[model samples]
Target chain A: MKEYKLMKGNEAIAEAAIRAGADGYFGYPITPQSEVLEYLMAQKPHERTGMVVLQAESEIAAINMVYGAACTGKKVMTSSSSPGISLKQEGISYMAGSELPCVILNVIRGGPGLGTIQPSQGDYFQAVKGGGHGDYKLFVLAPSSVQEMADFAKLGFELAFKYRNPVLILADGIIGQMMEKVQFFDQQPRITDEEIIKKYPWTTTGKTPNRERNIITSLYLEAIVEEQHNRKLQEKFKRMEEDLMFEKIECDDADYILIAYGSVARICQKSMELARANGIKAGLLRPITLYPFPSKQISGLAGKVKGILTVEMNAGQMVEDVKLAVMGKTPVAFHGRMGGMIPSPEEIVSALKNKLIGG
Target chain B: MTEEIIIAGFGGQGVLSMGKILAYSGIMQEQEVSWMPSYGPEMRGGTANVTVILSDERISSPILSKFDTAIILNQQSMDKFESAVKAGGLLLYDPHGITKHPTRKDIQIYKIDASEEAAKMGNTKIFNMIVLGAYLKVKPIVKLENVIKGLQKSLPSRHHHLIPENETGIKVGLEMAEKIN
Candidate 1:
């Protein structure tokens, strides 16, 4: 039966991870997102679903554990805040290069060296443009609500295994800390050892004499071989564009547009309403997948709209992407707040007027 | 109908829990709800506040700069949130330690001595419930039976016995709350 309950976004993610039939959860605690680990520990999913939940020594260790568990073709995940996520970049890059499937949740806090525990979207460039080294990209999902926080757990794992790549749920502290009513899907049974081997032929599950041994490594000594691997990964990323997801609010008759994601998108919705109420026709474009960004749809909208205002909780990162998508067709302006500050609806409306509508 | 509420007080005063219960009650009544708290270090005996929005339509933002109703439990919260109430909205507070009462004439102001009432009841933890009761008395957004159901939903089964006491507190608040503006 589908159950409806009021839950914090972080708690919903943890509960969804269990219901999604995740094989293991390895993570270290951080503010705003610590409840993810706390809920899992308090619930003890291992007793219910035979899942493993571990509090690793550190963030780096936790991500590495995810990488190791993922190699065995089992569903694995790890979550952390900004500083903790930074420590896991090396492992993320290795997982990307190795073509491993794993889910990583980053409930972003203010950055540039442990700035604050408050919400911020400063990690946009790092999450979408590649924080880790090498020609690699993570399938990034940005959830704006507690219900999405739960739904994306299953979706993230599905996308991860679909392309054998790392998937990131780039959430902020606001979404992680906020509470809302959410309807939870029924629990899914965990995959068995036999099912894992049969479903994933590439898995290194005690290689049988009938098939060749599986090797999981990011290291390629030869330059040409590494080039081939990079090309294959690039092709996979190109195909991921098919999964691009976004939401458009009142865009058909809009003269101006507000582009935002995650928590900022929620604020923009109100700003759009206020703008419309004040005789200014404004719409909102919320990109749910930050990596496979809705560039094509934005480019199309750019032709119809007079200007676009990009709002974020950081010092203008996603605005660059908006500018790229618009490609000079329309003027794209940036309105942002840094150090964990959130922009109010009135502030965003004023910015839209001043920057886009010419106050 | 949409009601944006800001409930502010100290950490131990059950400010967040009160907001949680209100949110659960909204859910029980089939209303869209969002609860965003000012989390982190401020939760440690310092001033803490939660923004709860209950709407028939989908809620846009969980965070807000203004509210239709402001429930202030402390002087710090009063000083910060008194003006945050929208013009002609509602301001409900407990004037326990407030040296300066609300001076706003644009909005409706009401006072409930929930702290004193909780003390008389010999259960300081129910202070927030009394305040919640007062808000319900004034706003009556959610039904009284649903508030009890919400209390049951938020509190664990072990604490189910306290539901009747909380209901009584809400009734007392309904009787004691007086419009001052």
Candidate 2:
């Protein structure tokens, strides 16, 4: 039987995490995303699926807890808002270097530093370009709707395990706080201890006589060894291009293109409608994955479109990527609002007219 | 059909929950719905508002600048959203704490004294349901049966007993709503 329920994006992620057979969740509460932790605590996944849900002392503690659990091959995750995410960078870097799989959710609030509790995509660079001190990338998924919020919980884990790297779900406050109907998938059973040992030979399980001890550490003492590790990580990231996801709307004969992601993408959809109604022939390109960016697709579209406009909730972060992809083939412009202000559909249309069409 | 609504009031006035119930009602009627709330510090005690969109088609943006209907519960919301309604749209409001009324000539304006009615009914908690009832009477976007089912779905089992009282509040709202040109 298909089950559907009305839920906030934050709540949906928590419920989906449990349904995704997550072995443990370690997180500290922070707004616009505190509901993620609150929902998990209330649902008591510990009682339901024997999934450990712990409220750590701080963001630093929570992320390290995820690091510890993930090293054991347990399906573990942690969530936070922007400031809290900043605190988790070191742990994330360590995990990435160690080649451990884990999920991290950033229900991003406005920030250069706790700027506001409102939604913003300011962490685009931090997420896709790497926030921590390393030459590693976090496979980033940006979900624009509550259904995607629920769907990505499972997908995040799968991609994380597949790449043996941290996967970040970069959502904003609008997508986090908004409520919509979500059809849930069937609950999956938690991976057992024996299964974890069998599936992950690199996991730091108990040492046995039959196999060598599984060591999990980010430390590479020799310079050459570290360089080799870095090269291997780069190769892994390069292969992730095969999994790039994106959506194109009305782009077949579009003269102008609007590129956006996450919550801003939904606004751009309305802008596309408004533009078409005015006989402007505009289209929208929404990138679902921020790390394995849809650069190839954007480059392909750039030749067909006369101009492109990038709309975001931050101050022109993703626009840089769009420009790089277009490669001077078409004029690229940026329209954004910072400190948690959201651009309306009309505003985006005006921006398109002013920056791309009329200008 | 698409109906974009904004419900705004003080924090304790059930603005968010009213939008939630309406979204649930839309779901009951097999409509696509989105509920976006103003979840800032203002929700602690200041003005709170929620945007609810119900449509036969997929909702594009949850955050909207203009609305098809504006359900104002307080004067601040009235001041803010009165001009936000599209021309020929509907403006339904409670005249409880409001001193100045809606003055839009292009839009249809209706007043429902839900706070007073709920006070008369001895339960101020159902005030929002009264306003919701009045809005439904004018708009009729979702069926009453679906609304009752929505109430059932949104409220916990322990509070199901209060559904009848809420239904009565809705009836009172339906009776008391008046359009003043």
Candidate 3:
């Protein structure tokens, strides 16, 4: 029987990774996300499932460790909060360039520089727009619940391997710290080195006598070769775009639509209800995948709604994407609360009344 | 039935744990629940609070501006959370540290001297259980037996021995809680 227990979102991610047959976890502890590492260490996944759990000296080192493990075709993961995630960007860009498969969890807190430990979606631009210097993108999965936190870890790894690119779990502090009932899966054994070599012939699993040696590096001095590599990466991204995931609520005849994701999406659900009660005809469109963003869906929605209001815990980051999706078909307004301050459903409703309905 | 509650007090007063236990009880009774705490600087001996939602349907926002019930343990929390309780909602509190009582006429207020009751029972750690008992007495959101089971589930196996004493503390609070106008 599957075990059900009360779990914090951070702890759920750690438990889920182990059950998902992840080969290794390399991370540095950061608040609102320290439980991920703490839970992993306490459970001793290394002893239980032969998974490698290592606490690196810094976020940069931790992400690089994930890079090294992922290069060998192993399912590896690393988690951190906003500031630390910022530190991992260079390594992430490197991994994306090398076409390595790995999962990175950013249990996001308020940011810019060492911001508050409270939940924030300020890292939207960073996660979705590619913070690292790159012509590449990370498949960003935004989880709003503890159960989703658990489910996304496994899903993140699967998506990472599917396109041979990095996948990020973009969570906020509220989802990381909140406790809720979560069901756990039985352990799955990690892929053997032989299995890895068989699945990923391009993996650098040591030079073999029978096959050509594989080289995993982002550096290509030849401009032509770099252009070809960039084209290939762009194609992979195009394929990933086919997997645009989102949740649309009460939008069948909605006069106005509220766009949100992660923790803020939940608040928008209540805001939609309040608006409906007041006969404002508001609906919610929650983008589950921030990258390969549900732009197509939003574009379709613009023709049906009078206007769209984008809600976030950042100062209008995702709003830009929403505006692009709407493409001037519908007026897109933005409402945000920054520096760890979460906007309430009431605040959202007021904004809708004053901004969308009034305008 | 959906109950959105806020339990607030000094960090050491078991505010977060009380909400956890209540949330677990809600789960034991087959209800959808979410327990969210005020972490970081506010949790270090300062006024800490947790929002616990128990609903028959899927809960939308775990963070809410208004609550169906506010369990205030200190004066600071009482001052802050009094206005947060919805009209006709329950305001449960311990009389020990509350200097200014809730003045809201629209909300029903109940005073449970849980600190005193716990002291009478010779264990201050059971203070939160007593307050929880008082809450149950006023609202009966979950069954008492389920709450006992919840207490058992919440505590580590090493602390299971304290369950009986916590039950007694709950009983004391149930008997002692008085409605305050």
Clashing pairs in 1: none
lDDT of 3 by residue, A258-342 (tens): 9999989998998898889988998899999999899889999999889999999998999998888889999999899999998
Weakest 10 consecutive residues of candidate 1 chain A by summed lDDT: A1-10
Q: Chain A TM-score per model, please list them.
A: 0.99, 0.99, 0.98
Per-prediction TM-score, please?
A: 0.99, 0.99, 0.98
- Give the clashing pairs for model 2: none
Per-residue lDDT of candidate 2, residues A67-176 (tens digit): 99998999999999999999999999999999999999999888898789989999999999999998999999999999999999999999999999999999999999
Q: Indicate the residue-level lDDT of B135 in model 1.
A: 97
The residue-by-residue lDDT of candidate 1 on A1-359, one tens digit each, is 35579999999999999999999999999997999999999999999899999999999999999999999999999999999999999999999999999999999999789889999999989999888999999999999999999999999999999999999999999999999999998899999999998899888898476888999999999999999999999999999998999999999999999999999999999989989999999999999999899999999999998999999999899989888899999999999999888899999999998988885
Scored by DockQ, the top model is: 2
TM-score quality measure for candidate 3: 0.98
lDDT for residue A264 in candidate 3, whole number 0-100: 92
Runs off by more than 4 Å, candidate 1: none
Error of 2 at A157 (Å): 0.5
TM-score of chain A, predicted model 1, versus the true chain A, to 2 decimals: 0.99
The CAPRI classification for model 2 reads as high
Superposed on all Cα atoms, the candidates' RMSDs to the truth, in angstroms, are 0.9, 0.9, 1.2
Model 1 Cα displacement at A169 (Å)?
0.0
